[model samples]
Target: MLDVLAGHAARVRAADPLAGGQDRLPKPGLGEQLVEVPGAVGLASMDRSGLDTLNATWGPLVVHRLHARVGGPDPEAALGALLDAWTAAPRREPGPLAVLWPSRDTAAVRALAVRGFAPTVTVAARPRRPPAGQATDPRVRPATADDLDGIARLYEALVAYDAQFGWVTPRPSTPARIREHLTGTLPRSWAWVAEHDGTVTGVVIVDPPPRSRWIASMVTRMPAAYLGVMYADPAVRGRGVGAALAAAAHARLDAWGVATTLLHHAVANPLSGPFWARQGYRPVHTQWVRQGRPSAR
Candidate 1:
């Protein structure tokens, strides 16, 4: 099984240089279980047992990674067999299951969809180098303690906007949570804001990837910076505020010597897909989701 996964990873990376190699499988911790099929594998955590407990949070997730050998005779049959094995495996608990695969692996994707998996999120990446002729607006600067309120407001606006588009569900205390998150992250992460006429119009937060047991060993060969959150005031949209903020953030990451920066955007987000594309980010991994019971038949 490990050899099969390793071979699949190699082929995926070869098909798309951005799809980085997959070296580490999800190791089961306490109360967790790891399951493997012919061309697919999954790690299931028992923290979530019901639909209500299944949200977008990372903990208590059932994550599956699948790959199919392209150009092989009866590739669909091979994938269907793997999917059957995976779905038939016993689960310690019931919760939302997420399956992720390379966007270029259309065979596996089609099989998953036939089994009821739907596209949820797309993780994209681009070189940290800023494009040529990039100009930083003098008004853009590193965030300060005094800028928390403005940043929080922008974040609140972002959450609300995302909610409107059904991309996220905003909680009642989302504003306060945003404020607290910004307060805690300011000192440790690189955050910047764009100002115009003495008001912040855009914000971008970048951070180095933290050590994690879940990340694949092969994927970590190249260090990456993460674009945690980037939000611009709707009123300031189309005025170059977002571009300026992104350029500044990229310049800083490049100077830090990171090889690449990664971020995920909802494929359904009309605003985000094109905006990030304009920033040179392309999809590497596509996260497909099944909201309810497993549909493996």
Candidate 2:
């Protein structure tokens, strides 16, 4: 089963160079992680002969990693069967089920759509390197403890903007929570804030990607960084605040000898999708979701 999954993963990676080149399977000793569709049990047991998919629960969220068979008999039907089995499977928790696949896997995407999955978030990655030109904005500098309040203000604006797109549910405590979280990240992580006329207008946070069993299995285990948060005041939009902040962050990450940087953004977000693309990030994995009950379309 592991070999079969590795073959599918290789195909997925070959289809897109930026892909992570691995799939997350349920940890060993977990019972019944693999489910074979009716009449496909024998085929599924043979190496590389049948489709392999992984289902796991992360907190309240159920995640399905769909694998498409290369040169399988009816690739679409195979994926559809897997989706049907996954949706009908009993769950220990209730929450949105997210189906993830390589962005280049159109067959699995079509099958997922038929199974009522809708593309939601796109995880993108890019090599860490210095921006082509130095940022002229001297206002963009390493964040200091005194800048916490300003950073929190910028985060509040970011949350408010994202709320418009249903990315966050804002509560009165949201700003305070963000400030507390940023406060903890300040000393250990690299952060920079963009200032305009003595007022911070933007902020970017960089941190080492959290190491997990899932990440350690990737074929290319290079030092990587994560863009934890990058937000600019709406009032400062289109004034190059975000670009300057990102450039500054990239310079720092590059100096740390990071090979790649990754971030996730909502595909439905009009601002984030195009903004990150302009920043040279390319979609590597796409997370499709089905909320509530599955509906055939």
Rate residue 163 of model 1 by lDDT.
Answer: 59
Write one digit per residue (lDDT tens) for candidate 2, span 1-297.
454465556667667755665544544343435555532111111111111111110011233343333324455666677677766877654556566567875654687787778887777776766545564577688899999999888777766665564324456456656767778878887889988899988899877655322442232435767776789887888888888888887777677667777776777888888888888787777877776533210
For model 1, how does the per-residue alpha-carbon lDDT over 210-239 read when each residue is reduced to its tens digit?
A: 622123222333577678678988778888
Clashes per model (N, Cα, C within 3 A): 1, 0
TM-score of 2: 0.79
Quantify all predictions' global Cα lDDT against the true fold: 0.65, 0.64
Q: Which predicted model would earn the best TM-score? A: 1
**Per-prediction TM-score:** 0.80, 0.79
Candidate 2 stretches with Cα past 4 Å from truth are 21-24, 28-32, 38-73, 130-136, 171-173, 209-221, 293-297
- Backbone clashes, candidate 1: 1
Q: Which candidate is the best by lDDT?
A: 1
